[model samples]
Target: MSERRYMISGGGTGGHIYPAIAIAEELKGRHPEAEFLFVGAKDKMEMTKVPEAGFEIEGLWISGIQRKLSLSNLMFPFKLMSSMLKARTLLKRFKPNVVVGTGGYASGPLLKMASILKIPTLIQEQNAYAGITNKWLAEEAQSICVAYEGMEQFFPKEKVVFTGNPIRKDLLEVRSKREAGLKHFQLDSNKKTVLIVGGSLGSQRINELIAGQLSWFEAENLQVLWQCGKLYYDRYAALETESVKVLKFISNMDLAYAVADVIISRAGAGAVSELSLVGKPVLFIPSPNVAEDHQTKNAKSIEDKEAAVMLREKDLDDKFEPVFKNLIQDIELQKKLSKNILTLAKPLATKAIADEVERLENAVR
Candidate 1:
């Protein structure tokens, strides 16, 4: 007999794509016989990333509808229609037992098609503020797995399961790897190391603030591991002195997190969850340009609990340097933030969601 199969969908940003990939990884690990296929936007980051992660993917013509009236809005009908047809064709041929969606442009059409085809469907919501795509698909989804509670405003209370966000397993199990990780990164045992990440595309405000403070960090006898993103690396590459290490990206984030005394990052949902699991004091610089100011909501959720700090983009220039420096110097404060944030960590998120997938599959069979 053929193995059971699944079709997972989500994309556009790493925030959505990475979590979907993590869920897929967990599912595959639990059922090695399960065959997994992915569906994402045709020209999205997922088209490349999903395949790179060793899964087959089919791209839809769909893209997110813009808020303001634009040329993209006019093309929406065509994109949606084409995507529906493409997704239906894939479903008709593969006959998956279940379809899982982590919210992004592609997930709506893919999951909607799965529901219409009488296949069990699920949605994983990653943000504190829900996205419209998931909100639209919620009525049809068998279960809407959520990272934040009180989402009954968008999804059915019965359908909502607060399973936390599925992060890379490496981030969860690194507690014992600290010394080895510090050594692997060539970080000093005695000096404090602050890990700064600005997402993959990079955050302009964050890079600017950190770049402006390079000399100060060195003066304090601090070491830095900076992921400046690909866009801003050239400008900051000159800051790579004896006390600083700057790279366009850090593929080994587990090791990076293991060595960090403090973390400076954008308050995306994925970063928040990872920071929580890493149990590090974090200062969040929420980007102003994102949808519905969701980053601010994400950062504030943790800040409300005194688990992390929030630094807005507009205030970052005058505010970040002092805040960053103060947090680095305050060992007791760092311990407090780390302890509090660890209180929010859900290390079993992957397993929790994977078990839900298994239960849903069994009921359908």
Candidate 2:
């Protein structure tokens, strides 16, 4: 029999990249001999990250339309035309059984091209507020997998599939990682560990607030695992306190989530999804820079359900420490947040999305 072949496209941030990776993992596992290819935006994180995840990736010359008129907007039409042509060439050469898009600007051209070629196509959208790229490609998509409910406002009602965002498989077993994580970090096993992760590229606002409030870790007898982010690492690298471990990046997020009693994080769709699986008491600081202010919307979805607490970036300087310290002491509130967040975990997101791809592939075959 011929080897099964597939192409997956998603990038820009970990939100889009990780879902595509998870689906690729699922497809690889189900079909051991399958060949997987990734299509990503040139100059985006996926150009570097997809290879790090052990896959071949091709970059397209496509960019998003700027909201305000800019020189970049003028070139978007030409880039789009170029990307479509390149994507078509890639599809014809790869002859994929199916093409999957996980919601990014790169996904727009690749999936749109796949649709034109009459190939099976799938999409997994992580946010409640869908991006313009995904929304425009909704009709071209064969399956639209999503995390939050009420996504019908953005896509076709009949096409939406409510499979929660996939998380790193290692995160599912928090109990097993707790002791090991404490040991690995060389921290006090008895003390409460508070973890602050600011997404992949890191959040400037979250990084600043954590840096300024390092004293609280000692005051509360809390052990801290602070991912300071690469951008701000140089500015704060001089602080080497015993109780606080400042890292440029955290590759072992599973262990951190496992041992953490509290988590301070940004409200990226991907981060929220994984944190939901960890089910810790989370304090969300949503970045205002994102398109459509989707990060704030994502934070509110959890906050309104009492699954997490929210602080706008502007308020963090004045209010973060007080809110965090008070939350730390409120064991009851912590329990409520933990329980509510756990209910939102869809650990099987990869498999669910994979099943959707297979169903669509079979339809055309």
lDDT, candidates in the order shown = 0.87, 0.87
Off by over 4 Å in 1: 67-69
Displacement of the residue 129 alpha carbon in candidate 1, Å: 1.1
RMSD to native, candidate 2: 1.6
How many angstroms is residue 135 displaced in model 1 relative to the true structure, after the best TM-score fit? 0.3
RMSD each, Å: 1.7, 1.6
Which residue ranges in model 2 land beyond 4 Å of their true spot?
A: 67-69
- Per-residue alpha-carbon lDDT of model 1 for 227-332, expressed as tens digits? 9987798989988876688888787888889888888999888888888999989999888788889999999999999999888887876787788778988889
Q: Count the backbone clashes (under 3 Å) in each candidate.
A: 0, 0
TM-score of every candidate relative to the true structure: 0.95, 0.96
